[model samples]
Target: MDAKVMNQILEIAFEKRVSDVHFEVDNPPFFRGRGQLIRSKLPKLKPEDTEFIAKTILEANKRQLDPSLREQDASYSLPNGGRFRVSIFRQKGVIGIVMRVIPPHIGSFEELNLPVVLSEIVKAPNGLILVTGPTGNGKSTTLASMLRYLNENYSYNIITIEDPIEFLFTSSKSCIIQREVGIDTEGFGAALKAALRMDPDVIMVGEMRDPETIDACIKAAETGHLVFSTLHTQSASSTINRLIGNFPPEVQEVMRQRLADMLVAIVSLRLVKDKSGENIIPVVEVMRSTTTIQACIRDGRLDEIEKHIENGVAQYGMQTLDQHLIQLCQQKIIAVDEAKRITRSMDLERKLMFTS
Candidate 1:
């Protein structure tokens, strides 16, 4: 397959710092930058153009475009060190593609404007740590930052099982091994299970997508390996509930008990525009496994988790999303209107403004 046209499109995306590039039949190419989609001035793509792009991308990655399958996900790296997570699918019986840019360098926690508490989360010796958020919300980037921290500071065998392996980590003080899901191993669950035998001191699972993967991650943590993973939940409480809810009703109680014992912390992130509206900043909700938090999880008092996070900000280094938003607003890192849109709690906003 000829990839010249696709390469040109990707090079443009790289230069513009575009977060995503979209190609669809009958629609002009578009770039999603700073949370907005901007259409290219170029004319709409023809069906053949999209088909050629799709085939070229798949061929470049040594993947096949199976018409029988409605969708496919892959990742490709450019010769100039740019990488993208590509999703190609059939829409209206025509090919369409979405490519997300992955930065070549992994930013530090401070560089990413992540909370300082994240440093503590990455330093833990062993337990399950989760970064939870919806897709395109910087969840993978946050986890990558943590792994990079460990790589730079400690000497351990770190194994990461990713679908397409987003960040490429160079060995600093650690022996880092990255395995792609379909390339290096069979899948997340199988790779995780094999990682246990690989003598990994730290393990990063790209995502906990199913019960088997979740159970394997918990077991790996229980067996004295520091495990980090991501989930598609909006809040700390929701992340916990989602994990336990993945199991059958009969096994949920058991899972909860295990989670209470083996869980370390949960960090939920949302990226909103900074004060200039030109960049995104993360508003985070952190929940550490204190004695009280452990009890709440074991006893199924999930509703109280948020309150604990609110009250424990000063003592436990836990912060609710509202608390973080308030801090950002007070520091002029984000405008009040933007903060209000994110928090979506006028009463809480008033309390934050009036308190102190």
Candidate 2:
């Protein structure tokens, strides 16, 4: 709870390249490194320790982490030039905190090892571009890289509505305005609607959490503003279904049509260690909105989308998850068994076998 102790814990986490630090009662602090939970070599923390750390972070950020209410999400900046996104909540009626380490430097697309096609996608004049995956899979980092690329390459007014603003971007060739949900404006929907009136050329919604935010993002894209957002889905088809599922059954069909019109691309990613198990690389599934893909969405033929992604890889710059895994395996970036574990398609399994 003390600043000195917190700094020490953070130093250890940073030095070990841990993604997250967790504190809970009756448990020693844990570090999530390379997607594995590693217990800290320290004594178990008491309830009071977690409570103190939670309150300390909240107070320093000038926010409240009231367990009686809902959980709190906030950002914290360390004195030694580190930033963290902190989630404080009640678990088993005790205080608990999870701090995700946000990298200070936003990496370029090449540095993040994203595909070259992403550079072309990010330069779209207007429409919705989604970078999706489950939690802790570098979705935010990927989105940040795209935005950073735009910031460096183009001259546009970019406005971002983030729950807790993660990567801080100074003005480059583009004019950037970042609004934190609680601190900058009322909420995501409000900030997004207001951003539209602000004449923004590019809008970044941190996460399309609810129907309201999703609707707002779609409308923003429809209005000719290049929009970027994230979803917690595994594949492009599932991402479309998840978006339409947010609306009522009666409106889902209409929403699907609207999404089909405005959708630009969907990139789903997963981070897996390389063959040596030393470095993590992203295996991506990309689905660009081509005429065939749009028809599938409009006709509600979601199941047919994957085949299109596979066949249209060369034509549309789209690739399925299995395709990416196969490439990684062929390149020896990942082992054959690792690719098999990550992929689900028998078709792709046979392809991997034959290719290997």
Candidate 3:
């Protein structure tokens, strides 16, 4: 109910490796780990308790809670420097809060169990790199790792436009500047436009939320700046369609050409419980741009993109979701049923029948 109790709750979450913590008016705080939400044994929260917790978060960020404010996005830090991406919203006329844990240190591809192909994907000198997935699937963390790789290896100027700025990066070989949406800049679109003029060699936009931001990303890539952003799509094909679909019908052709020219890679993520049923690992679908794939996008052959991606596994380090899931099952890292539950392929089970 008080600030110390709230901090204690977050500290406990950090110690337990919880991914998210939820607070609501009539329920005990819930902690999500390994894709399961477990209700705590603590007493259910009251209206004033939730409100006070929300107020404490707002004040920590030097902001006041407005009476008419129905939603808020912010970040909170513990005395030990643990960070959380905080979301506060009104539900049924009462306040509810959810805090997603941001890892204190960025993990490498091996540490996160991400495909080493991601190390290769981020090697592109200049183009758009998109990491797409449904929410809570570790999109942000993957991007952070890529940036970490760049920071340690390259001496480029990097700027990030984030909604609340999740990970705190200290420049290594590269000089880094991070801008938060409301506190540092107006929005993603405006910040992206300004990033282009700041002599940046690499720019990381937190998310492509609208047409203006998406267009800015494409243009930034076209002009030889490495761009990184995230989307909520499930696969490479849908990620392309969603980008081109954001524009008007008359201008979509132009948008497709721009995207085809600027795309470097698309990495889609799905988190499933590993064989031990104790840890979560990413099943990645990687689509690296090639001549054939670019032509498919340029000529509106979206359906054919997946086949090309699957076929490029040997040559270009590309793989479809089904391919990764099958590999996971083959290695006994994940169960076949777990793969089937997350896969979109119709014949995946049949293919697994042969392989498993």
Clashes of each: 0, 0, 0
TM-score for all predictions? 0.97, 0.97, 0.98
lDDT score for residue 158 of model 2: 99
lDDT of 2 at 73: 88
Residue lDDT tens for model 2, 52-109 = 8988888877776675845888888888878888888888888889999998889998
Question: Residue 145's C-alpha lDDT in candidate 1?
Answer: 92
RMSD score of candidate 3 (Å): 0.9
Candidate 1 local lDDT, residue 348: 63
lDDT of 3 by residue, 94-206 (tens): 99999999999899989999888888888899999999999999899999999999999999999999988999999999999999998899999999989988999999999
Model 2, which residues run further than 4 Å from truth? 346-348
TM-score of 3: 0.98
Task: Give the clashing pairs for model 2.
Answer: none
- Rank order by lDDT, top first? 3, 2, 1
lDDT of 1 by residue, 50-106 (tens): 888877777876777777858878787788889999888898888899999998779
Relative to the unseen true structure, what is the C-alpha lDDT of residue 144 in candidate 2, on a scale of 0 to 100? 94
Q: Write down the lDDT of every candidate, Cα atoms only.
A: 0.89, 0.90, 0.94
